[model samples]
Target: MKIKQGILFLITKSEVGGAQKYVREQIAICSKEFEVYLSTNEPGWLTEHVAGEIAGQLLDKRIESRTSIGYLTRLAKYIKEHGIGLVVTNSANAGMYGRIAAKMAGAASIYVSHGWSSVYNGGKLAFLLNRIERYLARLGDKVICVSAGDYEVARDKVGIAEDKLVLLKNCIFPVNATAAADRPAANGRLKLLSVARFAHPKRMDLLVAAMKGVTDAELYLVGGGKGEEEIRSYVHAQQLDNVHLLGEIKSFNGFGDYDAFVLISESEGLPMSGLEAMSAGMPLILSNVGGCKEIVVNESLLVNNTVEDIQRAIRALQHNYVQYKMPVKSFFDINFNLLVNQDKYLGLYRSLIK
Candidate 1:
């Protein structure tokens, strides 16, 4: 019998965001061919979902600072001791330390940039971050970019070599229990849903601001983060009765009730929530940033995430909703389906070993 090679996945934190979810999906998909292990800064949603299913370790380091010498040393020792053959790092901080540690431990490393936030951030901080990312790219064998937009930015803007970067768009398993709801009557109010961590690049405030002019619809925001208090205060001060903060929901049972799904983020990397909504055949309204355009039903549904554009897109979707909503499942099936692309990942990993 042949021994299965060991694969270790690492991420900066284990929060239930897009990057964390990506790592979780990789663990499930790759476990079929390899011995899967996971390392996160601390145990949270990712750990919770994968608990008892794999060998998980805690790094106990946040994404805040540069690499820690002690953390790197410990990680290298763990990789060497466990016979880990491949180290897959997700997010910026993990990519930095994990790639270096993988090299030190004699493991091939792959860095998955969930989104190149540094390139889009703008100003001196963005310049410094891009330089840092460019320098760090040398430590990894390959960098997986989740969207075409990010891929272009990595190659063109960040000046990473074309051969070293892989353009593998994000994928998700379809939602099974839910399907798109029938459009509400012309006289009824539109029900819109958005699932996002209320933080930077996710302009929930813009969505709420847009809701002020949208008396004909109710917007439900389903997430919690550092930005929650600020958003709550803004909503209360603005007295937007139509907007409701639904917090985090782990199930898709209630998704079928919404007329449409909206994500007016300032930046994104092919959001899992948007794909989940589309898997349920819900129409998705997204901002024109990152990989959002790659999944939208139509260009008309793309917004600048401004209050004006969001309000406009909502009204447009409400006016001709069925036309926009009908093809959601088809779009998701063709582009973002995980079942179809799982082999691509397997092939990539296999090739890396050879």
Candidate 2:
């Protein structure tokens, strides 16, 4: 019998987010062909879900400090000791340290950028970080971009060679058709859902402000983050009784009663929340940034991440409810389906192997 090649998946955070979800889903598919191993900063939902599937060893790759010599040395040592052939790194910190460590250990590395946050976020720090990313791209065999917007930035702006970059969009597992088929009857109120971390780029604050004008709709915001208190305070101050905060949800199952799924952010890299909502046959009202445009049902659903625009978008969605629903489902099936992405991933992995 042919021995399965060893592959190490390194991600900086163990928290529940889009990047963590991508790592978890990749593990499930890659484990079927490779001897899978995982390393993270600490234990959380990502570690918990992957525990049973991985080979019985975990590496604490102390990844908090990007300049930590110990971080590089320890991770490199592990790769050499285990004879790991391929190292797949997720997130920015992990991408930097993990790629260098993989190179040091003589294993091929692929840096998967969830999003080029620094470049897209834009500020003084962005210039320096973008330079650093361009330099680091040389250490990895290839960089996988989750969105077309990211791909353009990585190549055109960051100046990474086209040969070293791969464009693979985000995807989700097949949702239950029967469950997703159920549409709540149109009551007097228009029910809208926005699932996102209340942080930079994700302007839940604007969504709250937008809610003031969207008097006829009930806005359900389902996420918790550093910006949660701020959002909650604003909601309280405005006395926006129509805005409901559902906190963090482990499973998106049974969240299918909304008229439209909304994510008003400054930027994104193919958000899993949007894809999940699309799978459930819900239309999207997203910011026209990153790859959000790729998943939107129509041009009208893409907003400018402003209070006025988001308010206008919500009203538009309410007016043309039936037109958006079927297209959202059909688009998910054709473009962002699980089976299509699985084939691309497995093929990419095989090609990278010597």
Candidate 3:
């Protein structure tokens, strides 16, 4: 197992959300086997939240802090000067810059599609971006998809060739498994937790609306985003006493504070939060969308975006209508383990370099 010492470039728009977290984890792992150099607009809450040692290996390549031609030029210069062998871009904006920059710098470019970006949803701008992405796909040495669904969208909709695509599910260290297992259940009422940014795609509104129907359960909305004020206004206007907006929990171990986990997102790329919840042995109630269906295997309680469906899921979990073994450890072993999947990525990199 001779590890290569080639320079690797990791790019992301911002250190936020699942893509950011996934890139950070991969950077932490890859740094052990390669000289990993990271480039991003700025530090985000998610990047700051990771453990100190994992965060230390990341070398920030300062760009314009905004996704633009100026930033792309800066990234190109950095890649050339550093003799970067491989450029791995996480998410849409970074992918846009990294793909072109890697080509200019004579480095093998790898684009990691974390989810279907807003651009893929449909619009003149979205159409233009999708076209750009399609053209760029051919330039990339490899296009890594975070989920099977995302892979389909990249191939069928984005027009990326099948041979260029690869699936790499999101992975996280089950660091809190033991602590989460030790957490006591709610004595007075069941705690339902949703860990996501307060954004439209997350469909937190549906969960808030559904909570109106559940009198006995308490809902905790974690994470922050543009929709925070709107969510707060709805909570205050509705006067939902059972719902609590606890903001973002800075530590991964902080998840042990809850009983059950739920995510009502409209789309996802094998959400790590859900995996984290499962690792904690918490019963999960996820929206029947994207990789969520692949994760929530207990089909009996799968929820949808509709308020009625979410309400039904909450009620069902409350009444013991669904039962399934907690596959937390197995899930990690199957998907996230470095020994299981890192070698696959290493192989891909080596193949390209050869």
Candidate 4:
């Protein structure tokens, strides 16, 4: 069967995080089966990273980038020019604009809800964005949630219909699975790695405070964000010698060096870092939020987003470290592989068209 022609519009303000990476990978995979086109802003790290593949597929534009007016104009023009049958938007900014543009252009639209960007936790601006999202959900043909937890929030809290929502688990390539079997023994110092942008919701401060009770073990803070300076200041203020802030290491070439991986986020849909950590054969310690508990299973430790809870989990994991075997990579291969999940998306596309 001849594949459909579609436009994958990514309106991420920044490209240095998991959502951008997810969009990029999805585009790459979907391109194999569809005439996939990408739309994103210029001068973004994501744009720069995606430049090599942008030869014929990418559309570079400096639109309102976030608001509907600027994005709808650019998106409508592109859809008209390319005969795009479907529009898929990732992230909140793109979801808003893409849904509106698809509606205006009379095209089918799928909005992927990565997470609740502006929740009750954020301030006035966040509340406003939340309202915008609720409005956008009503306009979209379908809203894709990366986790069931997120889907529930959208349905119950945001007033999106259950039928309008689709559950699509985040996909990850488990490159580390093969190498994990040959991993070296844990050194005397238990190494805990957290790979996430230093943002407000990530709550790295809680992790740092949790480390106070964890003796001798080292904590590696990977990834950079707006919270870098503040997180650094707090680390300095606390004299956290055991915590090492290693700014965003994109490739996990040396990931095996760490004994285990941990994340202490206030919220998430499904963090790719935790998935990567699991694939790398490292036991996971995650905050009991979002879909993390779903991935971690009994083999991993779940803690509340508090210093004491985090510290207790860390210590408990360290004490029972030897007994914990990394969850088998087969779990990811069977459930979260790109090929497998892509088929689910392809099925959704077919259903929509029919």
Query: For residue 273, what is the lDDT in candidate 2?
Result: 88
Ten residues in sequence with the least summed lDDT for candidate 3: 53-62
lDDT score for candidate 3 against the true structure:
0.72
Per-residue CA lDDT of candidate 1, range 1-354, in tens? 222667889888887777777887888888767777888777688898877556556556544356578788878888888878888998777888888998898889899987787877656688788887887788778999989998999998888888889989999878774676678546678999999888887888888999999999998889888999898999899899999998877643467878898988777878888888888899889989988899997989998857998899999988898899888888888888998888888788877752
TM-score of each: 0.94, 0.95, 0.87, 0.88
TM-score of candidate 1 on Cα atoms, chains taken together:
0.94
Query: Model 3, 26: alpha-carbon shift in Å?
Result: 0.4
Among all windows of 10 consecutive residues in model 1, the one with the lowest summed lDDT is 56-65
Which candidate, 1 or 4, has the higher lDDT? 1
The better-scoring model by lDDT among 2 and 4 is: 2
Per-model C-alpha RMSD: 1.9, 1.8, 3.2, 2.9
By TM-score, the best candidate is: 2
Q: Candidate 3 — which residues are off by over 4 angstroms?
A: 1-7, 45-67, 118-120, 177-188, 338-340
lDDT of each: 0.83, 0.83, 0.72, 0.73
**Per-residue alpha-carbon lDDT of model 4 for 1-354, expressed as tens digits?**
346556555565545677877777776666656666677766666666555553244345544344446556867777767767777888666777777777777778888877876663546686576677778878878988898888888877676788789999888766544433233244557888888888867988888887777767899888888888888888899888889999877654455677778888878888888777766677788888888777775634888888888887777776776555445455666767775667787778656542
Q: Roughly what TM-score does model 4 have, to 2 decimal places? A: 0.88
- Error at 138, model 1, angstroms: 2.1
Candidate 2 — worst ten consecutive residues by lDDT sum? 177-186
Q: lDDT tens digits, residues 230-279, model 2?
A: 88888899999999998988755544767678888877889898888888
